[model samples]
Target: MKKLILLLLTAILALGCTACAARPYTPAGEPTGNAALDEQVLALLQELCDPKADLVTNLGAVYDFLCTGITYRATLADTSGGFTDELTDSLALELLQKRKGNCDAQAALTAVLLRRMGCEAQIVQGTFLRADDPEPVDHAWVYAVVNGTDCWFDPLYGGHFAENPRDYFMADDSRMALTHQWDAAAD
Candidate 1:
Protein backbone atom coordinates (compact mmCIF):
# COMPACT_ATOMS: atom_id res chain seq x y z
CA MET A 1 0.00 0.00 0.00
CA LYS A 2 2.83 2.42 0.80
CA LYS A 3 4.54 1.72 -2.56
CA LEU A 4 1.27 2.23 -4.48
CA ILE A 5 0.61 5.56 -2.76
CA LEU A 6 4.08 6.80 -3.61
CA LEU A 7 3.67 5.82 -7.27
CA LEU A 8 0.35 7.66 -7.54
CA LEU A 9 1.84 10.82 -6.00
CA THR A 10 4.74 10.69 -8.40
CA ALA A 11 2.41 10.31 -11.37
CA ILE A 12 0.31 13.27 -10.26
CA LEU A 13 3.37 15.47 -9.78
CA ALA A 14 4.67 14.54 -13.22
CA LEU A 15 1.34 15.41 -14.84
CA GLY A 16 1.27 18.79 -13.09
CA CYS A 17 4.73 19.64 -14.30
CA THR A 18 3.86 18.62 -17.84
CA ALA A 19 0.83 20.87 -17.81
CA CYS A 20 2.88 23.85 -16.70
CA ALA A 21 5.53 23.23 -19.33
CA ALA A 22 2.98 22.87 -22.13
CA ARG A 23 1.24 26.12 -21.31
CA PRO A 24 1.76 28.67 -24.09
CA TYR A 25 3.12 32.12 -23.45
CA THR A 26 0.62 34.81 -22.46
CA PRO A 27 -0.55 36.27 -25.80
CA ALA A 28 -1.53 39.86 -26.50
CA GLY A 29 -4.88 41.32 -27.67
CA GLU A 30 -8.24 41.53 -25.92
CA PRO A 31 -11.29 39.50 -26.72
CA THR A 32 -14.40 41.10 -28.21
CA GLY A 33 -16.39 40.06 -25.11
CA ASN A 34 -19.23 38.89 -27.33
CA ALA A 35 -19.53 35.15 -27.08
CA ALA A 36 -21.36 34.74 -30.37
CA LEU A 37 -18.96 36.93 -32.28
CA ASP A 38 -16.07 35.09 -30.71
CA GLU A 39 -17.63 31.80 -31.75
CA GLN A 40 -18.03 33.02 -35.28
CA VAL A 41 -14.38 33.93 -35.44
CA LEU A 42 -13.36 30.55 -34.05
CA ALA A 43 -15.66 28.82 -36.48
CA LEU A 44 -14.08 30.71 -39.33
CA LEU A 45 -10.67 29.65 -38.13
CA GLN A 46 -11.82 26.06 -37.94
CA GLU A 47 -13.00 26.31 -41.50
CA LEU A 48 -9.65 27.70 -42.57
CA CYS A 49 -7.38 25.03 -41.07
CA ASP A 50 -7.59 21.72 -39.37
CA PRO A 51 -7.76 21.90 -35.58
CA LYS A 52 -4.88 19.42 -35.41
CA ALA A 53 -2.67 21.33 -37.84
CA ASP A 54 0.68 22.73 -36.74
CA LEU A 55 1.01 26.38 -35.71
CA VAL A 56 2.82 27.57 -38.85
CA THR A 57 0.43 25.71 -41.11
CA ASN A 58 -2.51 27.23 -39.27
CA LEU A 59 -0.99 30.70 -39.53
CA GLY A 60 -0.51 30.25 -43.27
CA ALA A 61 -4.13 29.19 -43.65
CA VAL A 62 -5.27 32.31 -41.79
CA TYR A 63 -3.11 34.58 -43.95
CA ASP A 64 -4.45 33.02 -47.12
CA PHE A 65 -8.02 33.33 -45.92
CA LEU A 66 -7.64 36.96 -44.98
CA CYS A 67 -5.99 37.89 -48.28
CA THR A 68 -8.26 36.01 -50.63
CA GLY A 69 -11.47 35.34 -48.78
CA ILE A 70 -12.10 38.93 -47.74
CA THR A 71 -12.14 41.94 -50.02
CA TYR A 72 -10.14 45.02 -49.10
CA ARG A 73 -11.90 48.29 -48.35
CA ALA A 74 -9.80 51.44 -47.96
CA THR A 75 -11.93 53.01 -45.26
CA LEU A 76 -11.15 53.12 -41.54
CA ALA A 77 -13.89 52.91 -38.98
CA ASP A 78 -14.55 56.14 -37.13
CA THR A 79 -13.56 55.29 -33.54
CA SER A 80 -12.96 58.79 -32.18
CA GLY A 81 -15.47 58.68 -29.28
CA GLY A 82 -16.10 55.01 -29.19
CA PHE A 83 -14.76 52.14 -27.04
CA THR A 84 -11.13 52.57 -28.11
CA ASP A 85 -8.85 54.07 -30.71
CA GLU A 86 -8.04 50.69 -32.16
CA LEU A 87 -10.38 48.10 -33.68
CA THR A 88 -13.52 47.52 -31.63
CA ASP A 89 -15.68 44.45 -31.32
CA SER A 90 -18.43 46.05 -33.36
CA LEU A 91 -16.01 47.01 -36.09
CA ALA A 92 -14.53 43.52 -36.24
CA LEU A 93 -18.02 42.03 -36.49
CA GLU A 94 -18.91 44.52 -39.19
CA LEU A 95 -15.82 43.50 -41.11
CA LEU A 96 -16.97 39.92 -40.95
CA GLN A 97 -20.48 40.76 -42.10
CA LYS A 98 -19.39 43.07 -44.91
CA ARG A 99 -16.29 41.04 -45.77
CA LYS A 100 -14.29 44.20 -46.42
CA GLY A 101 -12.21 46.65 -44.42
CA ASN A 102 -8.99 48.64 -44.34
CA CYS A 103 -5.66 47.58 -42.90
CA ASP A 104 -6.83 48.01 -39.33
CA ALA A 105 -9.56 45.49 -39.71
CA GLN A 106 -7.27 42.99 -41.38
CA ALA A 107 -4.64 43.32 -38.70
CA ALA A 108 -7.17 43.14 -35.89
CA LEU A 109 -8.77 40.08 -37.31
CA THR A 110 -5.39 38.45 -37.76
CA ALA A 111 -4.37 39.19 -34.18
CA VAL A 112 -7.62 37.99 -32.67
CA LEU A 113 -7.63 34.86 -34.76
CA LEU A 114 -4.04 34.11 -33.86
CA ARG A 115 -4.74 34.56 -30.17
CA ARG A 116 -7.63 32.16 -30.38
CA MET A 117 -5.45 29.67 -32.25
CA GLY A 118 -3.00 29.53 -29.34
CA CYS A 119 -0.25 31.75 -30.72
CA GLU A 120 1.22 35.01 -29.45
CA ALA A 121 0.11 37.88 -31.73
CA GLN A 122 -0.38 41.61 -31.65
CA ILE A 123 -1.74 44.27 -33.99
CA VAL A 124 0.86 46.78 -35.15
CA GLN A 125 -0.19 50.26 -36.18
CA GLY A 126 2.29 52.11 -38.35
CA THR A 127 2.75 53.96 -41.61
CA PHE A 128 3.47 52.57 -45.04
CA LEU A 129 4.32 54.15 -48.36
CA ARG A 130 2.99 52.85 -51.60
CA ALA A 131 5.33 52.96 -54.58
CA ASP A 132 2.93 55.15 -56.50
CA ASP A 133 2.28 57.51 -53.59
CA PRO A 134 4.75 60.14 -52.45
CA GLU A 135 3.40 60.36 -48.89
CA PRO A 136 3.33 57.63 -46.32
CA VAL A 137 -0.10 56.54 -45.11
CA ASP A 138 -1.29 54.99 -41.89
CA HIS A 139 -1.40 51.22 -41.94
CA ALA A 140 -1.76 48.22 -39.66
CA TRP A 141 -0.31 44.76 -39.71
CA VAL A 142 0.23 41.74 -37.45
CA TYR A 143 3.30 40.37 -35.70
CA ALA A 144 3.07 36.84 -34.40
CA VAL A 145 5.43 34.35 -32.87
CA VAL A 146 4.70 31.00 -34.41
CA ASN A 147 6.40 27.79 -33.42
CA GLY A 148 9.30 29.71 -31.85
CA THR A 149 9.78 31.85 -34.99
CA ASP A 150 9.01 35.57 -34.99
CA CYS A 151 7.04 36.40 -38.11
CA TRP A 152 5.12 39.24 -39.66
CA PHE A 153 1.95 38.96 -41.69
CA ASP A 154 0.61 41.81 -43.84
CA PRO A 155 -2.67 40.88 -45.45
CA LEU A 156 -3.32 44.06 -47.36
CA TYR A 157 0.19 44.43 -48.77
CA GLY A 158 0.55 40.76 -49.46
CA GLY A 159 -2.79 40.35 -51.18
CA HIS A 160 -3.28 43.69 -52.88
CA PHE A 161 0.04 45.45 -53.32
CA ALA A 162 2.96 43.07 -53.38
CA GLU A 163 4.13 41.70 -56.68
CA ASN A 164 4.73 38.46 -54.84
CA PRO A 165 2.13 37.81 -52.19
CA ARG A 166 4.26 35.37 -50.22
CA ASP A 167 6.92 37.97 -49.48
CA TYR A 168 4.86 39.49 -46.69
CA PHE A 169 4.41 36.28 -44.77
CA MET A 170 7.03 35.39 -42.18
CA ALA A 171 8.98 38.49 -43.13
CA ASP A 172 11.87 39.83 -41.10
CA ASP A 173 12.12 43.37 -39.72
CA SER A 174 14.56 44.57 -42.39
CA ARG A 175 12.40 43.34 -45.27
CA MET A 176 9.27 44.86 -43.77
CA ALA A 177 11.00 48.19 -43.09
CA LEU A 178 11.40 48.91 -46.81
CA THR A 179 7.78 50.04 -47.05
CA HIS A 180 6.58 50.11 -43.47
CA GLN A 181 7.79 52.50 -40.79
CA TRP A 182 7.11 51.92 -37.11
CA ASP A 183 8.77 52.31 -33.72
CA ALA A 184 10.98 49.27 -33.43
CA ALA A 185 11.19 49.66 -29.68
CA ALA A 186 7.43 49.76 -29.22
CA ASP A 187 6.76 46.34 -30.68
Candidate 2:
Protein backbone atom coordinates (compact mmCIF):
# COMPACT_ATOMS: atom_id res chain seq x y z
CA MET A 1 0.00 0.00 0.00
CA LYS A 2 2.84 2.35 0.85
CA LYS A 3 4.54 1.55 -2.43
CA LEU A 4 1.33 2.20 -4.27
CA ILE A 5 0.94 5.52 -2.55
CA LEU A 6 4.48 6.43 -3.45
CA LEU A 7 3.94 5.54 -7.10
CA LEU A 8 0.74 7.51 -7.18
CA LEU A 9 2.46 10.50 -5.67
CA THR A 10 5.35 10.25 -8.06
CA ALA A 11 3.06 10.06 -11.07
CA ILE A 12 0.88 12.91 -9.89
CA LEU A 13 3.84 15.13 -9.14
CA ALA A 14 5.46 14.33 -12.44
CA LEU A 15 2.36 15.22 -14.40
CA GLY A 16 1.42 18.19 -12.21
CA CYS A 17 1.11 20.42 -15.21
CA THR A 18 -2.51 21.44 -15.73
CA ALA A 19 -2.58 21.16 -19.48
CA CYS A 20 -2.42 17.61 -20.77
CA ALA A 21 0.94 17.07 -22.48
CA ALA A 22 0.04 14.83 -25.40
CA ARG A 23 0.01 14.72 -29.16
CA PRO A 24 -2.95 16.12 -31.04
CA TYR A 25 -5.63 13.52 -31.70
CA THR A 26 -4.53 12.67 -35.25
CA PRO A 27 -4.47 8.89 -35.39
CA ALA A 28 -3.38 6.61 -38.32
CA GLY A 29 -5.66 6.92 -41.37
CA GLU A 30 -7.54 10.06 -40.42
CA PRO A 31 -6.15 13.25 -41.84
CA THR A 32 -8.50 15.97 -40.60
CA GLY A 33 -10.37 16.09 -37.30
CA ASN A 34 -14.07 15.44 -37.52
CA ALA A 35 -16.38 18.00 -35.95
CA ALA A 36 -18.78 15.32 -34.81
CA LEU A 37 -15.97 13.41 -33.16
CA ASP A 38 -14.69 16.54 -31.51
CA GLU A 39 -18.20 17.24 -30.22
CA GLN A 40 -18.49 13.70 -29.01
CA VAL A 41 -15.33 14.02 -26.99
CA LEU A 42 -16.28 17.47 -25.73
CA ALA A 43 -19.75 16.35 -24.78
CA LEU A 44 -18.37 13.51 -22.74
CA LEU A 45 -15.73 15.73 -21.21
CA GLN A 46 -18.31 18.30 -20.18
CA GLU A 47 -20.35 15.63 -18.53
CA LEU A 48 -17.32 14.24 -16.68
CA CYS A 49 -15.52 17.48 -15.81
CA ASP A 50 -17.53 19.10 -13.07
CA PRO A 51 -16.07 22.23 -11.62
CA LYS A 52 -17.95 21.65 -8.38
CA ALA A 53 -16.55 18.19 -7.93
CA ASP A 54 -13.14 17.37 -6.58
CA LEU A 55 -10.59 16.17 -9.07
CA VAL A 56 -10.58 12.61 -7.79
CA THR A 57 -14.34 12.36 -7.85
CA ASN A 58 -14.49 13.81 -11.32
CA LEU A 59 -11.80 11.45 -12.53
CA GLY A 60 -13.63 8.52 -11.02
CA ALA A 61 -16.69 9.60 -12.89
CA VAL A 62 -14.67 9.69 -16.07
CA TYR A 63 -13.29 6.23 -15.42
CA ASP A 64 -16.71 4.84 -14.67
CA PHE A 65 -18.24 6.48 -17.70
CA LEU A 66 -15.79 4.98 -20.13
CA CYS A 67 -15.80 1.57 -18.53
CA THR A 68 -19.54 1.40 -18.57
CA GLY A 69 -20.08 3.26 -21.80
CA ILE A 70 -17.63 1.62 -24.15
CA THR A 71 -18.05 -1.95 -25.35
CA TYR A 72 -15.12 -4.33 -25.25
CA ARG A 73 -14.12 -5.97 -28.53
CA ALA A 74 -11.81 -8.86 -27.77
CA THR A 75 -9.12 -10.16 -30.11
CA LEU A 76 -6.18 -12.54 -30.09
CA ALA A 77 -3.48 -9.89 -30.59
CA ASP A 78 -2.92 -6.16 -30.40
CA THR A 79 -3.00 -5.73 -34.16
CA SER A 80 -5.83 -8.13 -34.80
CA GLY A 81 -4.92 -7.45 -38.43
CA GLY A 82 -6.57 -4.05 -37.97
CA PHE A 83 -6.37 -0.82 -35.98
CA THR A 84 -6.46 -2.36 -32.50
CA ASP A 85 -2.80 -1.84 -31.61
CA GLU A 86 -2.35 -0.43 -28.12
CA LEU A 87 -0.36 2.56 -29.33
CA THR A 88 -2.51 3.56 -32.26
CA ASP A 89 -4.15 6.98 -32.35
CA SER A 90 -6.62 5.95 -35.06
CA LEU A 91 -8.06 3.32 -32.77
CA ALA A 92 -9.10 6.03 -30.38
CA LEU A 93 -11.09 7.86 -33.02
CA GLU A 94 -12.65 4.65 -34.21
CA LEU A 95 -13.65 3.83 -30.64
CA LEU A 96 -15.34 7.21 -30.30
CA GLN A 97 -17.48 6.34 -33.32
CA LYS A 98 -18.00 2.61 -32.95
CA ARG A 99 -18.47 2.62 -29.17
CA LYS A 100 -16.84 -0.79 -29.13
CA GLY A 101 -13.17 -1.62 -29.03
CA ASN A 102 -10.67 -3.86 -27.34
CA CYS A 103 -8.28 -2.76 -24.61
CA ASP A 104 -6.33 -0.58 -27.02
CA ALA A 105 -9.35 1.42 -28.06
CA GLN A 106 -10.68 1.70 -24.55
CA ALA A 107 -7.33 2.80 -23.15
CA ALA A 108 -6.83 5.27 -25.95
CA LEU A 109 -10.24 6.79 -25.30
CA THR A 110 -9.59 6.91 -21.58
CA ALA A 111 -6.29 8.72 -22.02
CA VAL A 112 -7.79 11.14 -24.51
CA LEU A 113 -10.66 11.97 -22.19
CA LEU A 114 -8.31 12.46 -19.25
CA ARG A 115 -6.19 14.88 -21.23
CA ARG A 116 -9.22 16.79 -22.43
CA MET A 117 -10.45 17.01 -18.86
CA GLY A 118 -7.20 18.75 -17.91
CA CYS A 119 -5.31 15.83 -16.47
CA GLU A 120 -1.93 14.84 -17.74
CA ALA A 121 -2.40 11.23 -18.79
CA GLN A 122 -1.12 8.46 -21.05
CA ILE A 123 -1.95 4.96 -22.17
CA VAL A 124 0.14 2.03 -20.93
CA GLN A 125 0.72 -1.39 -22.43
CA GLY A 126 1.19 -4.34 -20.12
CA THR A 127 0.45 -7.92 -19.21
CA PHE A 128 -2.37 -8.81 -16.80
CA LEU A 129 -2.96 -11.68 -14.38
CA ARG A 130 -6.41 -13.03 -13.73
CA ALA A 131 -7.25 -15.29 -10.83
CA ASP A 132 -8.85 -18.03 -12.94
CA ASP A 133 -6.45 -17.59 -15.81
CA PRO A 134 -3.39 -19.82 -16.10
CA GLU A 135 -1.05 -17.11 -17.30
CA PRO A 136 -0.63 -13.42 -17.89
CA VAL A 137 -2.38 -11.66 -20.78
CA ASP A 138 -1.63 -8.57 -22.76
CA HIS A 139 -3.70 -5.49 -21.88
CA ALA A 140 -3.81 -1.72 -22.04
CA TRP A 141 -5.02 0.97 -19.65
CA VAL A 142 -4.50 4.57 -18.56
CA TYR A 143 -2.33 6.43 -16.02
CA ALA A 144 -3.25 9.90 -14.86
CA VAL A 145 -3.31 12.34 -11.97
CA VAL A 146 -6.38 12.57 -9.79
CA ASN A 147 -6.83 15.14 -7.09
CA GLY A 148 -3.06 15.64 -7.19
CA THR A 149 -2.46 11.94 -6.64
CA ASP A 150 -1.12 9.70 -9.36
CA CYS A 151 -3.58 6.98 -10.29
CA TRP A 152 -4.01 3.99 -12.57
CA PHE A 153 -7.24 2.90 -14.17
CA ASP A 154 -8.32 0.05 -16.41
CA PRO A 155 -11.18 1.34 -18.51
CA LEU A 156 -11.63 -2.14 -19.89
CA TYR A 157 -12.72 -3.09 -16.42
CA GLY A 158 -15.76 -0.94 -16.98
CA GLY A 159 -17.16 -3.59 -19.27
CA HIS A 160 -15.48 -6.43 -17.39
CA PHE A 161 -19.05 -7.28 -16.17
CA ALA A 162 -17.81 -7.87 -12.64
CA GLU A 163 -19.77 -6.93 -9.53
CA ASN A 164 -17.00 -4.84 -8.03
CA PRO A 165 -15.95 -2.30 -10.62
CA ARG A 166 -14.34 -0.02 -8.03
CA ASP A 167 -11.81 -2.76 -7.48
CA TYR A 168 -10.17 -1.57 -10.67
CA PHE A 169 -10.09 2.15 -9.93
CA MET A 170 -7.25 4.37 -8.73
CA ALA A 171 -5.18 1.30 -7.94
CA ASP A 172 -1.79 1.51 -6.35
CA ASP A 173 0.87 0.05 -8.63
CA SER A 174 1.68 -2.74 -6.16
CA ARG A 175 -1.95 -3.82 -5.90
CA MET A 176 -2.11 -3.71 -9.67
CA ALA A 177 0.99 -5.87 -9.83
CA LEU A 178 -1.20 -8.72 -8.69
CA THR A 179 -2.97 -8.48 -12.05
CA HIS A 180 -0.97 -6.04 -14.16
CA GLN A 181 2.57 -5.60 -15.50
CA TRP A 182 4.02 -3.22 -18.06
CA ASP A 183 4.81 -4.97 -21.36
CA ALA A 184 8.43 -4.25 -22.13
CA ALA A 185 8.04 -5.51 -25.67
CA ALA A 186 5.33 -2.93 -26.28
CA ASP A 187 8.04 -0.32 -26.14
Candidate 3:
Protein backbone atom coordinates (compact mmCIF):
# COMPACT_ATOMS: atom_id res chain seq x y z
CA MET A 1 0.00 0.00 0.00
CA LYS A 2 2.69 2.40 1.02
CA LYS A 3 4.83 1.58 -1.98
CA LEU A 4 1.96 2.12 -4.39
CA ILE A 5 1.16 5.47 -2.87
CA LEU A 6 4.82 6.44 -2.99
CA LEU A 7 5.12 5.44 -6.63
CA LEU A 8 1.97 7.38 -7.51
CA LEU A 9 3.24 10.39 -5.56
CA THR A 10 6.58 10.17 -7.30
CA ALA A 11 4.91 10.06 -10.66
CA ILE A 12 2.84 13.10 -9.76
CA LEU A 13 5.92 14.97 -8.67
CA ALA A 14 7.76 14.09 -11.85
CA LEU A 15 4.89 15.37 -13.91
CA GLY A 16 4.66 18.45 -11.76
CA CYS A 17 8.26 19.30 -12.41
CA THR A 18 7.76 19.08 -16.13
CA ALA A 19 6.97 22.29 -18.01
CA CYS A 20 3.85 20.71 -19.41
CA ALA A 21 1.29 18.23 -18.12
CA ALA A 22 3.24 15.07 -18.76
CA ARG A 23 1.89 11.60 -18.10
CA PRO A 24 1.75 11.18 -14.34
CA TYR A 25 3.22 7.92 -13.24
CA THR A 26 0.54 5.66 -11.89
CA PRO A 27 2.14 2.29 -11.27
CA ALA A 28 -0.44 -0.27 -12.29
CA GLY A 29 -0.56 -4.03 -11.47
CA GLU A 30 -0.16 -3.04 -7.84
CA PRO A 31 -3.14 -3.53 -5.54
CA THR A 32 -4.22 -0.02 -4.70
CA GLY A 33 -7.98 -0.17 -4.39
CA ASN A 34 -9.25 -3.69 -5.07
CA ALA A 35 -7.04 -6.73 -5.07
CA ALA A 36 -9.57 -8.88 -6.89
CA LEU A 37 -9.89 -6.43 -9.74
CA ASP A 38 -6.11 -6.11 -9.91
CA GLU A 39 -5.70 -9.85 -10.27
CA GLN A 40 -8.39 -10.01 -12.92
CA VAL A 41 -6.65 -7.39 -15.05
CA LEU A 42 -3.30 -9.07 -14.53
CA ALA A 43 -4.67 -12.48 -15.44
CA LEU A 44 -6.29 -11.12 -18.58
CA LEU A 45 -3.07 -9.36 -19.58
CA GLN A 46 -1.12 -12.54 -18.95
CA GLU A 47 -3.59 -14.48 -21.04
CA LEU A 48 -2.96 -12.05 -23.89
CA CYS A 49 0.83 -12.48 -23.90
CA ASP A 50 2.50 -15.74 -24.87
CA PRO A 51 5.87 -16.31 -23.17
CA LYS A 52 7.26 -17.88 -26.35
CA ALA A 53 6.48 -14.76 -28.37
CA ASP A 54 8.96 -12.00 -29.22
CA LEU A 55 8.61 -8.49 -27.71
CA VAL A 56 6.80 -6.98 -30.69
CA THR A 57 4.64 -10.06 -30.92
CA ASN A 58 3.73 -9.78 -27.25
CA LEU A 59 3.03 -6.04 -27.58
CA GLY A 60 0.91 -6.56 -30.66
CA ALA A 61 -1.11 -9.24 -28.88
CA VAL A 62 -1.65 -7.04 -25.80
CA TYR A 63 -2.59 -4.00 -27.88
CA ASP A 64 -5.11 -6.07 -29.80
CA PHE A 65 -6.57 -7.39 -26.56
CA LEU A 66 -7.22 -3.92 -25.17
CA CYS A 67 -8.65 -2.54 -28.40
CA THR A 68 -11.02 -5.48 -28.75
CA GLY A 69 -11.93 -5.80 -25.09
CA ILE A 70 -12.90 -2.28 -23.98
CA THR A 71 -15.39 0.12 -25.46
CA TYR A 72 -15.33 3.92 -25.63
CA ARG A 73 -17.89 4.69 -22.97
CA ALA A 74 -17.37 7.71 -20.81
CA THR A 75 -17.68 7.20 -17.07
CA LEU A 76 -19.84 10.31 -16.95
CA ALA A 77 -22.92 10.59 -19.14
CA ASP A 78 -22.31 14.30 -19.69
CA THR A 79 -19.82 14.46 -22.56
CA SER A 80 -20.85 17.82 -23.90
CA GLY A 81 -18.17 19.34 -21.70
CA GLY A 82 -15.58 16.84 -23.01
CA PHE A 83 -15.29 14.19 -20.29
CA THR A 84 -11.72 13.22 -21.07
CA ASP A 85 -10.30 15.24 -18.19
CA GLU A 86 -12.68 13.78 -15.61
CA LEU A 87 -12.39 10.23 -16.90
CA THR A 88 -8.61 10.38 -16.57
CA ASP A 89 -8.95 10.11 -12.80
CA SER A 90 -10.24 6.54 -12.82
CA LEU A 91 -7.55 3.97 -12.10
CA ALA A 92 -6.84 0.93 -14.26
CA LEU A 93 -8.94 -1.38 -12.04
CA GLU A 94 -12.03 0.82 -12.25
CA LEU A 95 -11.71 0.97 -16.01
CA LEU A 96 -11.50 -2.82 -16.24
CA GLN A 97 -14.34 -3.51 -13.81
CA LYS A 98 -16.55 -1.07 -15.68
CA ARG A 99 -15.41 -2.51 -19.07
CA LYS A 100 -15.60 0.88 -20.73
CA GLY A 101 -13.91 4.25 -20.48
CA ASN A 102 -12.57 7.25 -22.38
CA CYS A 103 -9.21 7.33 -24.14
CA ASP A 104 -7.52 8.17 -20.86
CA ALA A 105 -8.70 5.01 -19.14
CA GLN A 106 -7.91 2.80 -22.08
CA ALA A 107 -4.44 4.25 -22.50
CA ALA A 108 -3.69 4.06 -18.79
CA LEU A 109 -4.77 0.45 -18.63
CA THR A 110 -2.74 -0.35 -21.74
CA ALA A 111 0.39 1.30 -20.36
CA VAL A 112 0.09 -0.61 -17.10
CA LEU A 113 -0.41 -3.94 -18.78
CA LEU A 114 2.50 -3.35 -21.15
CA ARG A 115 4.76 -2.33 -18.28
CA ARG A 116 3.84 -5.49 -16.41
CA MET A 117 4.80 -7.49 -19.47
CA GLY A 118 8.22 -5.71 -19.54
CA CYS A 119 7.44 -3.18 -22.25
CA GLU A 120 8.33 0.49 -21.66
CA ALA A 121 4.97 2.20 -21.83
CA GLN A 122 3.57 5.58 -20.81
CA ILE A 123 0.34 7.49 -21.23
CA VAL A 124 0.47 10.56 -23.48
CA GLN A 125 -2.06 13.32 -22.89
CA GLY A 126 -2.89 16.21 -25.18
CA THR A 127 -5.43 17.38 -27.73
CA PHE A 128 -6.98 15.28 -30.50
CA LEU A 129 -8.61 16.84 -33.49
CA ARG A 130 -11.99 15.18 -33.78
CA ALA A 131 -13.28 15.40 -37.33
CA ASP A 132 -16.59 16.82 -36.17
CA ASP A 133 -14.88 19.76 -34.55
CA PRO A 134 -12.49 22.34 -35.96
CA GLU A 135 -10.35 22.32 -32.84
CA PRO A 136 -8.51 19.65 -30.92
CA VAL A 137 -10.08 18.18 -27.79
CA ASP A 138 -8.41 16.76 -24.72
CA HIS A 139 -7.36 13.15 -25.27
CA ALA A 140 -4.93 10.52 -24.01
CA TRP A 141 -3.17 7.52 -25.54
CA VAL A 142 -0.36 5.06 -24.90
CA TYR A 143 3.22 5.43 -26.19
CA ALA A 144 5.41 2.37 -25.96
CA VAL A 145 9.07 2.18 -26.98
CA VAL A 146 10.78 -1.01 -28.03
CA ASN A 147 14.09 -1.44 -29.85
CA GLY A 148 14.49 2.34 -30.05
CA THR A 149 11.23 2.80 -31.90
CA ASP A 150 8.32 4.79 -30.48
CA CYS A 151 4.99 3.20 -31.19
CA TRP A 152 1.68 4.93 -30.56
CA PHE A 153 -1.48 3.09 -29.58
CA ASP A 154 -4.92 4.53 -29.03
CA PRO A 155 -7.24 1.69 -28.11
CA LEU A 156 -10.13 4.10 -27.83
CA TYR A 157 -9.77 5.29 -31.40
CA GLY A 158 -8.43 1.89 -32.43
CA GLY A 159 -11.98 0.57 -31.98
CA HIS A 160 -13.46 2.16 -35.11
CA PHE A 161 -10.59 3.93 -36.86
CA ALA A 162 -10.07 1.36 -39.57
CA GLU A 163 -11.13 -2.04 -40.95
CA ASN A 164 -7.49 -2.98 -40.45
CA PRO A 165 -6.91 -2.34 -36.75
CA ARG A 166 -3.14 -2.34 -37.23
CA ASP A 167 -3.56 0.99 -38.99
CA TYR A 168 -3.65 2.45 -35.50
CA PHE A 169 -1.41 -0.21 -34.03
CA MET A 170 2.16 0.87 -33.37
CA ALA A 171 1.72 3.99 -35.44
CA ASP A 172 4.82 6.03 -36.11
CA ASP A 173 5.15 9.54 -34.65
CA SER A 174 4.82 11.32 -37.99
CA ARG A 175 1.45 9.71 -38.68
CA MET A 176 0.16 10.44 -35.17
CA ALA A 177 1.14 14.13 -35.38
CA LEU A 178 -1.39 14.57 -38.14
CA THR A 179 -4.31 14.45 -35.66
CA HIS A 180 -2.61 14.49 -32.26
CA GLN A 181 -1.00 17.63 -30.84
CA TRP A 182 0.99 16.29 -27.94
CA ASP A 183 1.39 18.55 -24.93
CA ALA A 184 5.09 18.59 -24.06
CA ALA A 185 5.44 15.73 -21.62
CA ALA A 186 8.82 16.59 -20.15
CA ASP A 187 11.22 19.45 -19.60
Evaluated against the true structure, the overall lDDT of model 2 is 0.67
Candidate 1, which ten residues in sequence have the lowest lDDT sum? 22-31
C-alpha lDDT of all candidate models, in order: 0.75, 0.67, 0.68
Q: TM-scores, in order shown? A: 0.75, 0.67, 0.68
Model 3 regions lying over 4 Å from their true place: 1-38, 76-90, 185-187
| Candidate 2 colliding pairs | 67-158
Pairs in clash, predicted candidate 1: none
TM-score of candidate 1 to 2 decimals:
0.75
Residues 38-155, candidate 1: write the lDDT tens digits: 8678667657776455667767887888888788776557533323523556566767778888887777777777777777877777889988899998788888887778879898
Error of 3 at 131 (Å): 2.8
What lDDT is obtained when candidate 1 is compared to the true structure?
Answer: 0.75
lDDT of 2 by residue, 1-187 (tens): 9999999998897787544554332211222254555567776656565655666677788778877877667633355343332334566677878788888778777777666666766678777877688797877787777657777888685358345777678877675666678853642
Better of 2 and 3 by TM-score: 3
**The best candidate in terms of lDDT:** 1
Winner on lDDT between 1 and 2 is 1
Error of 2 at 42 (Å): 0.6
Clashes of each: 0, 1, 0
Which regions of candidate 2 are displaced past 4 Å? 1-36, 75-88, 161-163, 183-187
Per-residue alpha-carbon lDDT of model 3 for 1-187, expressed as tens digits?
A: 9999999999999877885644323323344244565576567766776655677787788778777878777754333343242343345667778778777678767766766656677778777787778977877777887666878888667666655677677898887787778855530
